[model samples]
Target: MLEVSAAREIVLRHAKRLKADFTALMSSSLGQVIAADVASDVDSPPFDKSLMDGYAVRAADVSPTAELTVVEEIPAGKMPTKTVGPGEAVRLFTGAPIPPGADAVVMREKTDSPSADRVVIREVPTAGQFILRQATEMKVGETVIPAGTVLTPATFGLLASVGKTTVPAYPQPKVAVVATGDELVEPNRRPKPGQIRNSNGPMLTAQVALAGGLPRYIGIATDREDVLRSYIAEGLEIANVLILAGGVSAGDFDLVPKVLKDCGVTAHFHHVKMKPGKPLLFGTKGDKLVFGLPGNPVSSFVGFELFVKPALRVMGGHIDPPTATQKLTLSEPFAANNNRPTYHPAKRDGDGVRGLKWFGSPDLRAMLDADAFLVLPPGEVNYAAGAVVEVLPINRTAS
Candidate 1:
């Protein structure tokens, strides 16, 4: 069995960043990663413009309590017909182009308008006052958005400002999730005495989306080889990654490994030495990746967090994955003597974290308040309150 760190390293070694495909429309490029530097088509502000509704005056001509003749009036989006000369001013609104020969602006409140054509300067004007200079934010042909930038709403607006209608970007990877077991039923159906509802399928799908991959739930597959083989083949064709929940342990009915091999997937490692998620199987066929997660819901969730989420992030060109481990103090005393390292569910308590109610890996209900995982090392351990331990944040806001 491979260690958790070793298995994760193997997965990342195979998860190469996608190449740039230069046809991503800005309309649909949200959450996509930029493949190349986006250059601005024109200077930001385009020309020297007014920053406020005030009088544009020659700086040398405006003195304290000096009167000046109004040469012209320029509103936003309009040009100034007359330029300000000596002892002259132009009445311009915000965003209007600065009239020639005018070096500063005085707000209306700072000036006394004795008549429509003349104004008294109550304050001395300074050069470049209330002026937004051309190319102040960005110049033409300069890089507006750098490579590897993730597209957000604000970045989208920046792209539009730079006249970038389309960008070279790497889109979210498509992931297919399917559960395998004979005693499984959909959530809508009432399970019989020997059956239970399938929560792993939908839960893994949600995890995939949270990890920046587009998830497609492929329903469930029974214990039969024929059915499992069909689902694996279809997932391989449609998705960049395929996650099969269950049928990975050493049972006679555990047919995921054999079926995946028959479908041309080359296994890299199987069975990680981690609690709640030991029966993880990883493989690849060409550029497509495959994962066989444990049947238990909590184990499946942990497997995605440790391995699959990082793979999806790599495919989407994201540098930071969700498995950000931090060392934090435990808020309460706890004891565990597990042979394997445990990632127990936890919630933030004040500045530290406290473990939640848990009863082994199958207790999916305990994960309801799980924002982080308290990493407990293997071997006999008794931790006192305020003991510092490793913590993995699954939900950033919750932690």
Candidate 2:
């Protein structure tokens, strides 16, 4: 069996990066990756603007108890018409451009308007105070955002600030999810005595979507060789990444690996040295990647986090994807399982991690309330309640 890190390296080495495509800067592009660098056409704030609603005055013009004449009133979005000369000030609102020859601003609370045109300044003003200088955020021709950046709401706003109505982004990978088992039935149907509802299909589809990939469900295939072969072929034809759950383990009905080989996929690795997902299979056919995950829910989730998530991120043009490990202290004692590296579902409780009530790999309920997976490396016997350990946060995407 391959180690977890080795398996990840093998998978990523075989996964090819997808081509870039231009997309409109819309709500749908929030999680997409940027393909090229975006530069600003104009300086942010464009001019010397006021950060507060105050009077723009020259520092040398204001005395300890001097009353300066208000030359002009500048509201937001409007330019100042008059300059502040000696013993003069401009009444400006927040975000308004500062008048020429003004170097400082005094808050309205510090001064009283004895009359509409005349204002009494109570405090001496300092130069360059309360002013957002031109190009303070970004200068013209400066790269506001670089390639491989994940498009968040703030990223979109930055693009809009640079006048980018249409963004150049990497295309989301189309992922085909296939669940194979004779005892699996659709979620809407009542399962027979010997059958169970297919949870892996929906779970994988949701994972794919959450990782910024377009998921296509290719339905379930029975244990029959021909049936599984047909479904695998369809998935390969429709998706850049084909994920098959079940039929990869060394069972009598295990046929996905052979079927994938027949469909021209070259096997990269077969088994991983991790609990719940040791029977993982990774392969590639041409430019398309393939993964055969274990049938158990927890196994599938772990496999996706360890291998598939990084591959998807790389394909989508992310420069440095997130690693599935974080340093966290355990809130309670944890007994290590044999010698295999175990990823057990746990909750992040007030700066520490606590194990959830898990009933092995098939217990989907155990992970429902879990925010992370506590990683126990091999050879660990037992860790005390306060022992520090590595954790993998669940359902979190890399920025």
Per-residue error for 260 in candidate 2, Å, reads 1.2
lDDT, model 2: 0.89
Whole-model lDDT for model 1 versus the true structure?
Answer: 0.89
User: Which is the leading candidate under lDDT?
Assistant: 2
Model 2 residue pairs with clashes: none
Error of 2 at 264 (Å): 1.2
Give a tens-digit lDDT track for model 1, residues 1-399. Answer: 888888999999999887768654554567778888889989989889988888999898777899999989999988878867898999989899999999898888898898999999999878999999999999999998898788888888898898777788887889999999999999999999999999999899888877778899998999999999999999999999999999999899999999999999999999899998898999999999999999999999999999998899899888665367988889998778889988999997868998888998999999999989988889998899999989888853211
Candidate 2 residues 1-399, lDDT tens each?
Answer: 898988898888877778888899887777898889999999998999998898999998888778989999999989888879998999999999999999999998899999999999989988998999999999999998988888888898898889998878888889999999999999999999999999999999999988878899999999998899899999999999999999899989999999899889999999999987999999998899999999998899989889988899888877775455789999998886646888889999999998888988899899889989988777755889999989988874433
Among all windows of ten consecutive residues in candidate 1, which has the lowest summed lDDT? 390-399
Clashes of 2: 0
Candidate 2 Cα errors over 4 Å, as ranges? 396-399
Q: lDDT for each of the candidates?
A: 0.89, 0.89
lDDT of 2 at 210: 87
